[model samples]
Target: MPIDDVSAGHRQELRRGTVALACLLRLRRPDYGYALLEALAADGIDVDANTLYPLLRRLEKQGLVTSEWSTGETRPRKFYRTSDDGERLARDLTQDWYRLDAALRGVIDQGES
Candidate 1:
């Protein structure tokens, strides 16, 4: 395989876990599927619709999010919002991320020495 292919695969693997965290954070405000997709893209997450829809379904199944269909508009859309469990999870994940960031910083700093 090409070096680029290997690097791309690793990059995607790292991003996979982060997508769930980003979704949990953004869903603090309820949003429809398309809106959520746009919001994630605006935030530089760059998730595709095929990937996003499955992740949303999984999050909902895990009780990290709740969904409802809104019919008051021209077209009914399924809206998702983070649940209490999701908020707690986000907080915990944020703590973990900070710890990992600090550790990486230490490693990088040592390398510079």
Candidate 2:
């Protein structure tokens, strides 16, 4: 792989863990897969459909999220929202992220010297 490809792969590896955290945060208001995809993209997290559908399934299976079908609409959609467990996890992860971000900033500032 080229240098750019290698760096891209490393970037992706760093972001992989953030997906679940982002999903949990975004689902606070309840949304379907497609809407969630757009929301994530708007927020600078680009997640494709194939990846999202399965991640939603896994989150539901893990009890981190709850899903319900809205049949009242002409096109029924399965809406997902963060469960209590998910909310707690999101909160914890957010705190961890903030601490990590501060540490990273310090490291970067020192390296620039």
Candidate 3:
């Protein structure tokens, strides 16, 4: 397999979990699907609508998020926000991410020694 293809596979695997975590963090404030997608992109989390929509549905089903429809606009939009459970999960995940980052940095530093 080409090295680029190998790297791409690994990158996708790494990003899979991070995307969920990023969505949880970002949805602390209510936002519609498209707005959430744009905000995530602005924050450097590139996720496709195909991926995000399903993820949102799953999160809502899991009680990690809640949604309500806004009918005031000409086009009604479903806005989502993180639930209490999701907030807790986000905090825990953020701590784990920090721990993992530090551990990885230590490994790299040791390798450089």
Which is the leading candidate under TM-score? 1
> All candidates' lDDT scores?
0.94, 0.95, 0.95
Ranking by lDDT: 3, 2, 1
Provide the TM-score for each candidate, comma-separated. Answer: 0.96, 0.95, 0.95
Cα RMSD, model 3: 1.0
Q: Give Cα distance to truth, residue 106, candidate 2, Å.
A: 0.9
Taking all chains together, the TM-score of candidate 3 against the true structure is 0.95
lDDT of 3 by residue, 5-92 (tens): 9999899888899999999999999999999999999999989899999999999999999999999998999999999999999999
RMSD (CA, Å), candidate 1 to true, equals: 0.8
Higher-scoring candidate on TM-score, 1 or 2: 1
Flag the better candidate by lDDT, 1 or 3.
3
Measured with C-alpha atoms, the lDDT of residue 54 in candidate 1 is 94
* Candidate 2 TM-score, C-alpha based: 0.95
What pairs collide in candidate 3? none
Show the lowest summed lDDT stretch of 10 residues, model 2.
Answer: 44-53
